[model samples]
Target: MRIIAHRGASHAEPENTAAAFDAALVEGADGIELDLQLSRDGEVVVFHDATLARLGLRRARIRDHDWSDLAGLDVGRWFAGQATPHRMLRLTDVLAGWGGRTHLYLEIKHAEGRRGRDRHRELAERTAEAVRAAGLIDQVSILSFHEAALEAVHALVPTLALVRNVQRVGLLTRAAQQRAGLSALCVAVDRFGAAQRARLAALERPVYVYTCDTPAQFRRACDLDATAVISNGPAAARRWFAGQTSA
Candidate 1:
């Protein structure tokens, strides 16, 4: 199974910052997972929340402020430790920092209705453009909880793979991916079992699980036939994979 770093080895470093990404790479993660939002200046930035409040900034949303203001906020410090005084990083900066060294699974948080469909579409295009311009397009795939956002990206970059993030797993993810022709499905690790894995596998597609941290859970995921699993402790996954290789 592929081991993905949840928010860049977030258990060890700050989530979604350069330090976290570096930590993930050092921890032997196969890929890094990070969230994306649009800045007021139309730039794609890496962050998890709709607001900057969690990062200790006075602003509520990254979209509400221009890059000039957003740039000034210390996004790293709130996590404490090495992430102290973290800087809000541009998506471009992230791509530049870990472009060749790591594979990126980018989750777009900007949804339609809230941000409008057109704006979401534009965000998709802008993100794809940046990835292409950075020559890292092939190394990244897009994911989102918003169906429309994923659709927008699918329409723009049909060749690029998209993953569906379902909140309540039923047939929703399967249906969404079937309709959109998405490349992968990301479900909560606990929501799936062997039967579900077989069903998804029967369709000749891959399944991914999120935020599983322990070796036992990882082993369970493998038994469930997950194609990939995301975790904050990527080092644990690395050890598991090494064991498998040796076995």
Candidate 2:
């Protein structure tokens, strides 16, 4: 199974930063997953939250600030044992730095309090443009919890891969996935099991479980025959996978 770094080896480095992405590649992850949010100036920034509270900065909506304003924030200092400061990264920067080195699972984060379908469509368009500009469309797969976002992306880039990130496996989720022509299904680790795996397998789409950080969850992912396992501890997951292969 493929091992994808959730937020780019986030357990070792600041989530969604360049350092985390680079570290994931060094640790032998098959791919890196990162979140994307649009700034006030319409720049697609690589970040996880709509707010900066977790990074120890004054709580401010990411969409309310321009990329320039958000860029200077020190995001890494809050992590335990991390002395060096790390700035927020733009999607363009990440694409330039590690575009072709590994597959990208780019998730479009739904902006809180944002209404209407236009916003999601615009995000999909901008993200698609960035991927095309980097010439890494083939290596990038777009994922989102909002079906509208995936639909917009599919309409914009028919050939680009799309993954539906669902919290549960149900008829509604399955119908949406089928309608969107999604390339994969990313479900929460807790929601996945033998029956769910078999059902998804029958659909012929790869199942990628998310945010698995512990050894037992990694092993459970393997037992389910997941097509890929997304985890914060990419280094540990890589080590485990290597051991399994050699065993």
Candidate 3:
């Protein structure tokens, strides 16, 4: 099973920063996953949360601020004993820095509410452009929980790989997969069982489970023959897998 760094080895470094991404590569992750949202100026920024409060900054929606304003916030300070300070990273920064070196799982974060749905097309357009500019469209998979968001991306970049991210496996999830022409499915590790794994494998589409950090979970992913395992502790996962293989 492939080990994909969830938010760039987030357990070791602040999520969605350049440092974290670089660290994931150094730790031998097969790919890196990140979250994307639009800045006030229409730029694609790499961040997970809709607000900045989690990073110890004033509570503000990421979409409400310009990139310049977002960049000034010291995102690294929240993590204790961080070796170096990290700022927010742009989608371009990640693509340019580590695009071709490894696969990228880019999750398009939904906008704050109902009104944000209107910008899905523009988000898809911009994300497509960025991937094209990096010349890594083939190595990137666009992921979203919202079917409309994935549809928008497919319309913009038909050849790009798409994955339907679902918390649970069910009929609706299966329907979304067919409707979006998804290349793969990213399901929560706990919810994906042998039955679901067999079902997806039979369909010839890979199943990638997310947020797996413990050795037991990593082992389970391998035993289930998951296409990939997304984890916050890539280094630890790599170590465990290495031991398993060597043993």
User: Per-candidate TM vs. native?
Assistant: 0.89, 0.93, 0.92
Expressed as tens digits, the lDDT of each residue in 1-247 for candidate 3 is: 7899999988988888888898999889999999999988998999888888877666688888999998887778787788677898899998888888999999998886666877766777799878977888899999888787778877877888988887866743454446646888777777766666666666667778887998777766765678788999888988888898899
Best by TM-score: 2
In the range 51-163, model 2's lDDT, one tens digit per residue, is: 88887656688878998898888878777788788998888888888888889989998866645356567788899888887888899999998887888787777778998
| Candidate 3 wrongly placed segments (more than 4 Å) | 171-176
Please give the RMSD of candidate 2 to the true structure.
1.8
Q: List the residue pairs that clash in candidate 1.
A: 76-86, 77-85, 77-86
Alpha carbon deviation, residue 24, candidate 1 (Å) = 0.8
Each candidate's lDDT (Cα)?
A: 0.79, 0.82, 0.83
Q: lDDT (0-100) at residue 153 of candidate 2?
A: 80
**Local distance difference test, candidate 2:** 0.82
On lDDT, the leading prediction is 3
Give the count of colliding residue pairs in each prediction: 3, 0, 0
Which regions of candidate 1 fall more than 4 Å away from where they truly are?
A: 57-59, 82-84, 112-114, 173-176, 179-181, 244-247
Q: For residue 97, what is the lDDT in candidate 3?
A: 84
| Model 1: per-residue Cα lDDT over 180-247, one tens digit each | 55887777766666666666676666778887887767866786677888999899887877898799
